[model samples]
Target chain A: MDEKSTINKDSENIERGNNIEVWEDVVNIKDLLLSILICASAAMGGYLIAPDDPQKPLLYGLVGVVIGFLVSSMIIKPKRTLRFEDEEK
Target chain B: MDLSLIMELIAISIFGAVLYTIIGIAPGTDETAVLMPVTLILVLSGLQPISVLAFFISSIVAKKLTDSIPVAIAGIPGGVLSAPMVEHAMVLKNRGLPDVSIRKMASGSVIGTLIAVPLSLFLANLLIPFGETISKYSNEIFFGGAVFLALMTKNRWLALLSIVPFALLIQGLRHLYWGTGAVPEDTTVFTSFFLGITVGPIILKLLELLNKEIRSNLPRRTTNDIVLKQQEKVKGFPNPFKILDKKETGSAAFSSVLGVFTFFMSPAGMTIFLGEVISSRIKDPIKKATRAISSMDGVTNAAYISGILIPLIAIGAPLSPTALGPGMALFNAPPVFTEDHNLHHILSMGDFIVATVIGAVIAISLTYFVTVKYSQQICTFVFKYIPHEALLGVFLALVIMLAYMDAGLINIGGVILIGLVAGVLHRWGVNYGIQFMVLYAAPWIVGNLVF
Candidate 1:
């Protein structure tokens, strides 16, 4: 009975650990996809709107993608900050 | 105004006030989401300009007053602007003083609007001489305003950098629309972009369902019950002035005046700023919280009224963030009213004043009476009977349909894309004010530099 209980506990711990790892991986992927989507959509927007010239659309689209990349990189991720007493209640 | 115009204004005001009051009670229902489409439809249907203005002003006033109902009772904010009121409201709710809080907010709203309209009218008149000159420098002003708003955010540097990219995106889309040889309507492009930005957070959250782990972790409400204390029935014709004390009334009036003058500032930001400024002076915690809530309510109404009125009356441009955002249709509706010839050109000052005053009086009187008398009943019904998720789904559907109708099927895709991108920026602490400024200034930025 004791041996069986110990084995069950070990399995539960492994499952929980796997779940956490999977959650983290999903979050990372979501973040990456968000960035990529923003960049690609911006490029597409430029291409669609670019002046009637065929080559100009492509050039504008590339420029848009570059700007999107720069802006996304500049985004400041939110952080948890400890507050002191002086802050507004 | 003629008798026919006067009658029309009254009819429109009543309709708008009733419709918007109901919409305002439902938490998460945005003023813009409802106002934009409705105003567009009304204008397109050949409603008189004075009547449209009357409808627009009354709807806003009624909505702002009734929005406090959800916040004070259920602790769920009615909209983004009401979010700041929730903390103070929850405090009162936990103490079994929600009725008191509700009365305070409702009263504050009434007094605030009463103070704001005349003051804004006076200010608008004062600024009219410089209207043409101001409009001429709008491009430069927009650029400067964008930078100023960007720097006011938590992620200042990031927001500053974002302006260029956002501007580029808007210009690109505009170009694409024009390139298609479509009848050249700027409103269609802007509407989609605005809708995209407004609904971005919800889109991102929905998209997160792709991951089962994330979905499992999402918070779920177990029950929909909201408890409230019973109050004595008040006699006929409730007076808002009697409910609030001298200090609350004074503070609210002062804040409303401040809000009227600071027309360019974002309403939500102004609410917080005024609330904190008013509350901090009080030493007692309870008094501070209550006063803050009341003053915040005052600021909300005052800011909205002034923000819309000043710009519309003065420059005939959607200059303020509030005007540019929820009130965009008023300034620019195509095939009938365009940016070049808007409501300012169509309606006289006398018409604006009469419509606004009559609309405000009727809307506020009705909303205040209903709120003060039936607070508990309304709260119970909304929380117990209404399915929150179903309401959200309906609103989302409406938004999608509106986006499709305004732009094209392709613009629906554009809306989602913009929503997601803007949603990411929002989650990272970049605010709506900066986004709006960037959107409004994009054309000027591209015209001078990019071209």
Candidate 2:
């Protein structure tokens, strides 16, 4: 009975450890670039088709999309920090 | 007004509200995005404009109410409008009052909507003529809006600096197409807005993912316990207005007034400002801040819908992004359709009212059920079942598809490159909103100066 209980405890520890390992492995540079590309392309397309005016919504959206991307990638990503503090760091 | 029409209006309101709620609860969907597709379909249906208006009104209201759920339970905001709710909901969560607070908010919103409808419509009747006069100076209004934006943001100098680049980018693109004056026969002018919204973000994220060894890692959040706890906490009857602590009432009233202006400042932007003002006005910092956030969400949603009535009736423009859905639809419809005489014209007015009313009602109505029955379970289910990488992948595909549809594949490719370039600039802490303001306003500014 003691051995059986010990085995169960061992398995649970393994499971928790695996979960943490999996979580740590998830975020990569490739996924980040893909997101940036998706957003920027969206902005460019927006610039192309929005109501015809200067200070174009599309153009501004493009800038926003790009800014959001770069801040996340160059500054936010480099520090390997989580949360908003990474940007400041 | 019409009894038979009233029934139809209610039906549309209910349907619109449900759809809006669905979109609102789900992250990453915008009000404009949902309304745009529906508007397109309604236009094709050849239904009277009034019917379409009903759908618009109902949908907007529903969206406002349901959007708070995700923000309240998880940290995820429903849309741009529901962003303020995140902070408030977090406070409520920490205090073990998330359910009670949200229920009150839902109630307060409904009451606020009830108050806002007649009041705004009355104001709309009075202010529409003024809107007509002001709209004539679109350029001047744009300038004012830009200045307002500069004042509103963190670091005014940075905001001002951001405007120049946005203007250059917008003007350069427009000139590229029209300057050649070789008008491409079939190229649609409105495609750019759709493209910008869809592609710009996707490209930036894609680049980030590619550079890192890490994959997508989103947080796991659930609201089941909070919701169940809320159910157990409320004893007797639920008074929706209980959420509107004494101070919140005045803040809600004040926010209603701010929402009416047609300047290009985002609804979200104004709400944050209004929230700050209300928080300052109250004596209790905690309640003051929470109420301020609540009132900001309520007023922004109401004012955004109700305020547009002025521009739509007076000038042909609908100032709010949500209202733009119907206005753009109106423009795309037959030109012969008389502005006042058409059913669509009448429905547009009705739509504003319906959206306001339904959004408030549904939000209030659902708060209890959401808090008691499904909030925690639903949240838990989502976190447990949904994978972040899969979610990102799907959204990425959607963003790409939307961009491609807005322009062509070539434009899509160009947008990806542009996003990367823009992302680089963003790292330097450049202001995108100012850039956008410049993009549209620069051409006119330069034209005014040069010509």
DockQ of each: 0.02, 0.05
Clashing pairs in 1: A49-B175, A49-B176
Please provide TM-scores, in order, for all candidate models, with all chains considered together.
0.76, 0.70
Instruction: Give the C-alpha lDDT of model 2.
Output: 0.51
| Highest-scoring model, lDDT | 1
- Per-residue lDDT of B32-120 in model 1, one digit per residue for the tens? 76676678668877888888889989998888888898787666567657866877787777665667788789889998899999999
Task: Give the poorly placed runs of model 2, Cα more than 4 Å off.
Answer: A1-89, B84-108, B174-206, B213-238, B261-265, B280-289, B325-327, B334-377, B414-451
For candidate 2, write residues B1-451 as lDDT tens digits: 5677667666666677666666665554545555655655665566555556656655666666666665664445555566555666666654545454555455445545665667666666676557666556766655666667677666777666656565555455545545554335344333344334333444465555434343235332211222234244445545545656665666676666566443245555566666666676667645764686567666665665664445555555544443443235644444434434443245455555654454445444544345434444544444333333333333343445444545456445544554554455444443333333443356576666554
Please tell me which predicted candidate would have the highest DockQ against the true structure. Answer: 2
Off by over 4 Å in 1: A1-89, B1-5, B74-77, B87-99, B172-188, B219-221, B280-288, B447-451
For candidate 1 chain B, which ten residues in a row score worst on lDDT? B219-228
